[model samples]
Target: MILNGCAIVFDDEKYFSLSGDNVQCDQRYYITNPLTTQFHVKYKKKKEFSPKLLVLMTMSSKDVFDIYVHKGEQ
Candidate 1:
Protein backbone atom coordinates (compact mmCIF):
# COMPACT_ATOMS: atom_id res chain seq x y z
CA MET A 1 0.00 0.00 0.00
CA ILE A 2 1.11 3.55 -0.68
CA LEU A 3 0.15 6.84 0.94
CA ASN A 4 -0.76 9.46 -1.59
CA GLY A 5 -1.81 12.50 0.40
CA CYS A 6 -4.43 13.86 2.79
CA ALA A 7 -6.12 17.26 2.96
CA ILE A 8 -8.55 17.11 5.81
CA VAL A 9 -10.37 20.19 7.04
CA PHE A 10 -13.32 21.07 9.21
CA ASP A 11 -14.79 24.20 10.75
CA ASP A 12 -12.09 26.43 9.28
CA GLU A 13 -9.42 24.14 10.66
CA LYS A 14 -7.14 22.49 8.15
CA TYR A 15 -4.87 19.46 8.14
CA PHE A 16 -2.54 18.04 5.54
CA SER A 17 -0.53 14.89 5.17
CA LEU A 18 0.95 12.42 2.73
CA SER A 19 1.00 9.25 4.76
CA GLY A 20 -1.71 6.84 5.93
CA ASP A 21 -1.87 3.14 6.55
CA ASN A 22 -4.85 1.15 5.33
CA VAL A 23 -7.96 3.34 5.14
CA GLN A 24 -9.63 0.94 7.58
CA CYS A 25 -7.17 1.91 10.28
CA ASP A 26 -8.09 4.05 13.26
CA GLN A 27 -8.06 7.83 12.92
CA ARG A 28 -8.88 10.81 15.07
CA TYR A 29 -11.10 13.68 13.99
CA TYR A 30 -11.69 17.01 15.66
CA ILE A 31 -13.28 20.38 15.17
CA THR A 32 -10.63 23.03 14.63
CA ASN A 33 -12.83 26.07 14.29
CA PRO A 34 -14.54 27.18 17.51
CA LEU A 35 -17.48 28.72 15.72
CA THR A 36 -18.21 25.47 13.96
CA THR A 37 -19.11 22.54 16.11
CA GLN A 38 -20.20 20.09 13.43
CA PHE A 39 -17.86 18.61 10.89
CA HIS A 40 -17.45 15.59 8.62
CA VAL A 41 -14.54 13.58 7.27
CA LYS A 42 -14.78 12.14 3.82
CA TYR A 43 -12.23 9.54 2.77
CA LYS A 44 -11.72 7.92 -0.58
CA LYS A 45 -9.35 5.03 -1.24
CA LYS A 46 -8.37 3.60 -4.59
CA LYS A 47 -6.28 0.49 -4.85
CA GLU A 48 -4.16 -0.50 -7.74
CA PHE A 49 -4.27 -4.14 -8.66
CA SER A 50 -3.36 -6.50 -11.39
CA PRO A 51 -5.83 -7.84 -13.93
CA LYS A 52 -7.01 -10.61 -11.64
CA LEU A 53 -8.20 -9.25 -8.31
CA LEU A 54 -10.27 -6.38 -6.94
CA VAL A 55 -11.58 -5.46 -3.49
CA LEU A 56 -13.44 -2.63 -1.78
CA MET A 57 -14.53 -1.55 1.69
CA THR A 58 -16.52 1.35 3.16
CA MET A 59 -17.33 2.16 6.74
CA SER A 60 -18.82 5.10 8.62
CA SER A 61 -19.80 6.17 12.09
CA LYS A 62 -21.78 8.97 13.71
CA ASP A 63 -19.01 11.41 12.79
CA VAL A 64 -16.55 9.60 10.55
CA PHE A 65 -16.61 7.97 7.14
CA ASP A 66 -14.07 5.89 5.20
CA ILE A 67 -14.04 4.38 1.73
CA TYR A 68 -11.62 1.77 0.42
CA VAL A 69 -11.41 -0.17 -2.77
CA HIS A 70 -9.21 -2.32 -5.02
CA LYS A 71 -9.35 -2.51 -8.76
CA GLY A 72 -7.85 -4.23 -11.76
CA GLU A 73 -7.09 -3.26 -15.30
CA GLN A 74 -10.19 -2.13 -17.11
Candidate 2:
Protein backbone atom coordinates (compact mmCIF):
# COMPACT_ATOMS: atom_id res chain seq x y z
CA MET A 1 0.00 0.00 0.00
CA ILE A 2 1.47 3.27 -1.18
CA LEU A 3 0.25 6.66 -0.08
CA ASN A 4 1.73 9.93 -1.39
CA GLY A 5 4.88 8.32 -2.82
CA CYS A 6 5.66 6.18 0.23
CA ALA A 7 5.90 2.41 0.44
CA ILE A 8 4.14 0.36 3.12
CA VAL A 9 5.94 -2.65 4.57
CA PHE A 10 4.28 -5.86 5.68
CA ASP A 11 6.31 -8.77 7.06
CA ASP A 12 4.70 -11.71 8.86
CA GLU A 13 7.98 -12.66 10.66
CA LYS A 14 8.96 -15.27 8.04
CA TYR A 15 10.99 -13.60 5.32
CA PHE A 16 14.54 -13.57 4.05
CA SER A 17 14.85 -9.90 3.17
CA LEU A 18 13.14 -7.04 1.46
CA SER A 19 13.21 -6.68 -2.30
CA GLY A 20 15.47 -4.30 -4.17
CA ASP A 21 15.13 -0.48 -4.04
CA ASN A 22 15.52 0.14 -0.37
CA VAL A 23 16.74 3.51 0.81
CA GLN A 24 15.29 4.13 4.31
CA CYS A 25 11.77 3.27 5.48
CA ASP A 26 9.38 3.63 8.33
CA GLN A 27 8.66 0.82 10.81
CA ARG A 28 5.29 -0.19 12.18
CA TYR A 29 4.11 -2.96 14.52
CA TYR A 30 0.85 -4.85 14.67
CA ILE A 31 -0.39 -7.45 17.16
CA THR A 32 -2.24 -10.69 16.49
CA ASN A 33 -3.95 -12.53 19.35
CA PRO A 34 -6.23 -15.55 18.99
CA LEU A 35 -8.98 -15.38 21.59
CA THR A 36 -11.22 -18.29 22.45
CA THR A 37 -14.80 -18.27 23.64
CA GLN A 38 -17.18 -21.03 24.74
CA PHE A 39 -20.98 -21.00 24.59
CA HIS A 40 -23.63 -23.58 25.29
CA VAL A 41 -26.99 -24.08 23.63
CA LYS A 42 -29.73 -26.65 23.85
CA TYR A 43 -31.90 -27.27 20.86
CA LYS A 44 -35.09 -29.29 20.44
CA LYS A 45 -37.26 -29.95 17.38
CA LYS A 46 -34.68 -28.64 14.88
CA LYS A 47 -34.25 -25.35 16.71
CA GLU A 48 -30.95 -23.57 17.18
CA PHE A 49 -29.55 -20.73 19.24
CA SER A 50 -28.03 -17.86 17.33
CA PRO A 51 -26.43 -14.77 18.83
CA LYS A 52 -25.95 -11.34 17.31
CA LEU A 53 -22.45 -10.14 16.66
CA LEU A 54 -21.04 -6.76 15.67
CA VAL A 55 -17.69 -5.52 14.49
CA LEU A 56 -16.31 -2.01 14.94
CA MET A 57 -13.23 -0.39 13.49
CA THR A 58 -13.05 2.80 15.51
CA MET A 59 -10.71 3.39 18.40
CA SER A 60 -13.43 4.66 20.72
CA SER A 61 -15.89 1.89 19.94
CA LYS A 62 -16.53 -1.17 22.12
CA ASP A 63 -18.59 -4.31 21.74
CA VAL A 64 -19.39 -7.44 23.72
CA PHE A 65 -18.75 -10.76 22.07
CA ASP A 66 -19.69 -13.34 24.63
CA ILE A 67 -20.66 -13.94 28.24
CA TYR A 68 -19.19 -16.63 30.53
CA VAL A 69 -20.99 -18.53 33.27
CA HIS A 70 -18.70 -19.88 35.95
CA LYS A 71 -19.43 -22.83 38.20
CA GLY A 72 -18.56 -22.99 41.86
CA GLU A 73 -16.15 -25.64 43.07
CA GLN A 74 -17.48 -28.38 45.30
Candidate 1 minimal-lDDT segment of 10 residues: 9-18
Q: Against the true structure, what is each candidate's TM-score?
A: 0.18, 0.17
Leading candidate by lDDT: 1
| Each candidate's clash count | 0, 0
Clashing pairs in 1: none
> How does candidate 1 score on lDDT?
0.39
Off by over 4 Å in 2: 1-61
Tell me, by TM-score, which candidate is best.
1
For residues 1-74, write the lDDT of model 1, one tens digit per residue: 24346444322222222234334545645556746553334443535531333333333322334433344343
Clash pairs (backbone) in predicted model 2: none
* Model 2 lDDT at residue 7: 43
Model 2 lDDT tens row, 3-72: 6655444322221222322224523223353243222222123213322233222221233233333332
